[model samples]
Target: MRNLVRYCLILSVFIMFSCGENTDKKSGENTVEEVQTETEIQKSEKNVILFFGNSLTAGMGLETSEAFPALIQNRLDSLNYNYEVINAGLSGETTASGKNRINWVLNQDVDVFVLELGANDGLRGIPLEETRKNLQDIINSVKEKNPDTKIVLAGMQIPPNMGEAYTTEFKNIFPELAEKNNIALIPFLLEGVAGDPKLNQQDGIHPTAEGYEIVADNVWSVLGDVVEKE
Candidate 1:
């Protein structure tokens, strides 16, 4: 009888320990699964931004990876913001060209659009009214496709040599369009680097690597607000 009792006690203890280990293992698996699910959810909520413009947006004088849009992507990644930036910058593209490509660009899942066209138009001395109309249409088409997508219009100033009246008309186009469309606007895309020899490349038109930082800062000042809301 003593032997039987001892055997039964030993079996009971073994069974209890086995059950406890299985329960602990299940708890740990549940915790890991929960963590994975949360991470996926966070990833799905990330924002997608599209940069549409000409050579400036393409980082003509700099490496493809050093473009302002790429810099913005790097910054967002480093800050742990789940975001994707699409670079739709084409070399020597004008507002007309941008309008031509707008529809296709809109096919992507864009949450925010950074409009930076019209510089080439300004350079080519294209009619200001035509530039304005093309830009308006682009903005309208983008809104038609993604009504909720926020827009940031990157403005450009004509060189002073373009004549004061013409320059004023070109400079006024951006703010007017932004105001009318009720979108965010950056007054000057070049900002501190436009006339600075140290910041510009040999052509004096495009920015160097260091100059792109200033341009990035100009866009970021307006973009930061929109991102916060997103």
Candidate 2:
């Protein structure tokens, strides 16, 4: 019986050691995965051209790679721009919301900060002054983070149903902000694509894949002019 007791005691210690070894193995595997993730992030680091906007920037109802931002990346690749394009668009985002989150988004170095917001704000019939303030704040934050960063303001327009007075005021916000901030402006984001049913999706809001390509075209025209690097 005493011999049997000693064997069981030894077995328990072996089992405990085996469990400890498995635990350490799992910890080592996790450490390897963590290092791999960090390596991937480091490899992807490059000069950033950030697209900060709402659904249009988010590429709602379309594949992410087909979105305008990715298309911009493709253009950069062809031109050998050697920049990383980050799409920070979110659906239904208002200027106020964007203002709140701009600093966190600006955590990394951004070469170009393309601002595409205020459409949903206008749609909600929010006061023009408020929208202007929020947008200005966002621009200020970006400028503060990267003093040398180029700022591009993408103008947006809401339908005239909001009243001719409000529509005109909303339309005026972009140019006014652009002039105030001395930033490049795209006059209108949906310039050639707005009224064209063929280009817009069924909702008459977001663009189709082909339409997004045109959007990419509009952005590239302005972006190509402002981007300094090859």
Candidate 3:
């Protein structure tokens, strides 16, 4: 009877230990799942800053990291701003092409929309009216998708090669749209780096990597005011 009682007590302890181990494993699994859920929520909560433009925004002829948009991302990250910078730049992308592509780009949520087209259009000497209309349409599309999306128009200028009147009109498109739409504007996307040979690449159009740092500054000057950490 003593041996039987001792055996029963050991069996009870073994069952209790097994049950406790299983409970601990289940608890660990629950904690892991909770952590994963929190991480996913954090990812989904990050706001997007879309830089839509042509070669300049695409960082043509340089590493993607050297582009102004990426530099802007670095600044945002350093400032603890929870924003994702999407470089929707395409080489040789004109205002009309950008308008056509805007819908696809807007599939994702955008908090700040930096419109950086018209440079290519101006360079190509596309009709000022067409450029203006395409830009307006693009802005309208963005507004329609999300009225609250902050639009920052990047003003561009081309050399007198396009003729003085055309150059002036092309440059005017940006500010006019900004005023009409009541959105933010970057007076000149290539303020200090435009004519400087050192800042530009061999093509004399796109900025060099170092030049992009200044370009990033130009963007941030206006963008900083629009993007507030929420």
Candidate 4:
């Protein structure tokens, strides 16, 4: 009877161990499934933003990944926002060139567009009307392709040396286009960095690394509102 009782106790211990093992296996599977589900949600929520502009947007003096777009991506990551930024900036590209390439660039999955052209055009003394039309067409095309995508027009200001009339028209183009399209507008892309030697490169046209920070701030101020709405 003593031996039989001992045998029964041993069997009970074996059964409890088996039950615990099964429970642990089930819990492990559940944990894996939960992790996979969360990963899928993150992948699906990723937002794609495109930056279309000239050398300024291309990060002429800095590395591609260190540009303002990349900085903005970092900022978004720090804030826990799911986003992917594409830099479509072409060095020396004018408004006309941007217009020509806008269609090709829009072929990608774009959730938001940061239009920062016209600086080259302004420097080249391109007709303000033509620049405006090109920008207008680009915005319209993007809207047509992706009606839900948001457009953020980055305004530019020609140097005072460009003459009052030309500068006035160049600066006004962004606001007019944004207002007409009912899109977000960044009044000035350079803001605190423009004309500041410390922020600009030696050429006095492109921005330095510090200048990119100011540019990011200028963009963020307006983009924050749009992000909040989203």
Candidate 5:
């Protein structure tokens, strides 16, 4: 009789232990689900970082994730920056076109605006003075919408085919604007990626994925610095 009682006690203890373990497992799973939901909600609340430009900003020959803006987003994620990125790049957008489109883009709240337009203008022989004025107007418009919004202008250069006068003037527009507006300026958007056949696609204009990574590094140099100041 004592032996039977001992076995019953042991069986009861084992069942109790098993039930306790199952309850703990359920509690752990609920906690994990709650944490995941909270994380998703927090990510959705991040501020907007709009990348405005042409085909390069759009990642023409590469996957959307491979684009420099997306790469910047990834870097921000890794660095724990609470900003959401929006790539407002079109395949052939010029400075004039950008001015026309800026109003629509500004409809959304933007915390940081990175302008990369004007390469197409230079390539198409558009007037440098006109390009500069259009860019200034765009900056003014953004300021009108969000007075405290930070601006980062990406400088671009066309081939010497456009002549040294136009090319030099085009290159000078960015720094001049940066100083006048007191905004951040990326000296050259194509720093390490330009003129390298290995970095560019067959068109010799759009960058490959590898090239975009370098481009991101270039933007990050000035962008990271200015953002800290902002």
Candidate 6:
């Protein structure tokens, strides 16, 4: 009887330990699953800020991370802003071409839309009215997709090589669109960096990585207001 009792006690202890180990393994798996779910929820909660433009927006000669949009993303993260920056800028993209592709970019929801085309149009001496119309249509498309999406027009300028008359009119296009659409405007996207040989690449058009930093600042000046409201 004593030997039988001892064997029973040992078996009881072994069973308890086995059950405890199984419980701990199940608890650990649950914890891992919970963590993954929480991470996915956080990513889904972030609003998107889409930067739509041309070579300047694309960081032509620099790494994608060196672009102004990526810099803006860093700033947003530092400030604890819940926004995802989407760099939709394409090199050599003109306003007309941008209009065609704007719908595709709008496939996902966008809380903020920063329009940065027209520079290529100006350089190519494309008609100012055509440029203005294409931009307006692009803006309209965004609105139709999501009327609440905030629009920020990035104003651009070209040299007098296009003629003083054309240059003056080209500069006017941005403000006019902004006022007409009641959207925010970045007076000059290249404000401090434009025409500064040191800021530009060998092409004297696209900005270098350092120049994109200043560009990011210029963008945030106007973009900050829109982001804060969100």
- All candidates: CA RMSD (Å): 6.3, 5.4, 3.7, 5.9, 5.3, 3.2
Candidate 6 off by > 4 Å = 1-30
lDDT of each: 0.92, 0.92, 0.93, 0.89, 0.92, 0.95
| Pairs of residues at least 3 apart in sequence or in different chains that clash in candidate 4 | none
Which 10 successive residues of model 2 have the least lDDT summed?
221-230
Clash counts for the predictions, in order: 0, 1, 0, 0, 0, 0
Model 2 whole-model lDDT (C-alpha atoms): 0.92
- Lowest-sum lDDT 10-residue window in model 5: 221-230
- Native-referenced Cα lDDT, model 5: 0.92
Give candidate 4's TM-score: 0.81
Best-matching candidate per TM-score: 6
Candidate 4 C-alpha lDDT tens digits along 1-230? 99999999999999999999999999999999999999988876788888899898899988987789889989988998878788898899988888898889988878888999989888888888999999999998999999999999999897867799889978988998888999999999999998999988999978899899989999999987877666
TM-score of 1: 0.81
lDDT of 6 by residue, 1-230 (tens): 99999999999999999999999999999999999999999998899999999988888989999999999999999999999999998999999999999989999999999999999999999998999999999999999999999999999989899889999999999999999999999999998888899999988988888899999999999999999999
Predicted structure with the largest lDDT when compared to the true one: 6
lDDT (tens digit, per residue) of candidate 5 on 1-230: 99999999999999999999999999999999999999999877888889998999999988999999999999988988878899999999988999999999999989899999999999999988899999999999999999989999998888999888888988899999999999889999999889999999999999999999999999999878756654
Error of 4 at 141 (Å): 0.5
lDDT (Cα, tens digit) per residue for candidate 3, span 1-230: 99999999999999999999999999999999999999999988999999999998999999999999999999999999999899999998998889889999999999999999988787777889999999999999999999989899999889999888888888888899999999999999999999999999999988999899999999999999999733
Which runs of model 2 end up more than 4 angstroms from their true locations?
1-45
lDDT (Cα, 0-100) at 48 in candidate 3: 91
**Candidate 3 at 49: error in angstroms?**
0.7
- When summed lDDT is taken over every stretch of 10 residues in candidate 4, the lowest stretch is 221-230
Model 4 stretches with alpha carbons more than 4 Å out: 1-45
lDDT (Cα, 0-100) at 131 in candidate 1: 96
Per-residue alpha-carbon lDDT of model 1 for 1-230, expressed as tens digits? 99999999999999999999999999999999999999988866778999999999999977889899999998888887778888899998999988988998888778999999998888788989999999999999999998999999999997877788889999999999999999999989999999899999999999999999989999999998998888
